[model samples]
Target: MQRFTVTLVWVCFTLATFPAQAEELALTSTRTLAASCAACHGPNGNSLGSTPTLAALNQQYFIQRMQGFKDGSVSSTVMHHHAKGLTTEEVTAMAAYFAQQPRQTPQPLPHQSFLGAQ
Candidate 1:
């Protein structure tokens, strides 16, 4: 019984400290694949060009937007070429990549309390 307990502890400890290599690998690959979009969008999906920014979008929002573009639900001749080229694997990677990026917080307007959701 004591040996069983000790082995269980060892197993749990090993599992707990196992390096999170998969996440790192995924991020590296995603960063590479998503690099193509960074010219128009800011690095890591922070949009720098003349379109709606993608940084800070919730993961779900990023996925939805990418999926829409892929499916033609969102129409844009300029974006179509880029979007159509993306595979589900690439889109998922992009969503994960952008989700990991730092989000831009809009500066609060002074007296926003008075603005009341305007």
Candidate 2:
């Protein structure tokens, strides 16, 4: 009887921690996926040029645009390919991550030339 009670307590404790573990794993995966966007979107979704900024965007809007891109309803030079590769859950997670970031103007890169002059 005592062994049974102890086992039950252990099982309950393990189950209680499972959700937290899962949540952490999901966040990590989302962050890893989002890191790829930095190539053009800039760090934390702040665009360095004409590309649209992703930080602080409305979550639903982000999701909708991504879905559109995935479905080929939204036109893009490259986004359709990228969007089509992501799972819906990944898109939702990335949207949430970007929405929570604070937007910042990106600084020009060192040695950047302007107006055809250095």
Top TM-score hit: 2
- The digit string of per-residue lDDT tens for model 1 on 3-93 reads 9999999998877766666667877888888776667776656664576666656778877877888788987768767777888888877
Q: Give candidate 2's total backbone clashes.
A: 0
Error of 2 at 96 (Å): 0.9
lDDT tens readout by residue for model 2, 1-118? 9999999999999999999999999898898889889898989999988888999999999999999999989999989989999999899999999999899978777884577654
How does candidate 2 score on lDDT? Answer: 0.92
Indicate the TM-score of model 1: 0.60
**Model 2: per-residue Cα lDDT at residue 86:** 91
lDDT of 2 at 58: 97
Root-mean-square deviation of each candidate, in angstroms?
10.5, 5.1
lDDT of 1 at 36: 68
Per-model TM-score, in order, reads: 0.60, 0.80
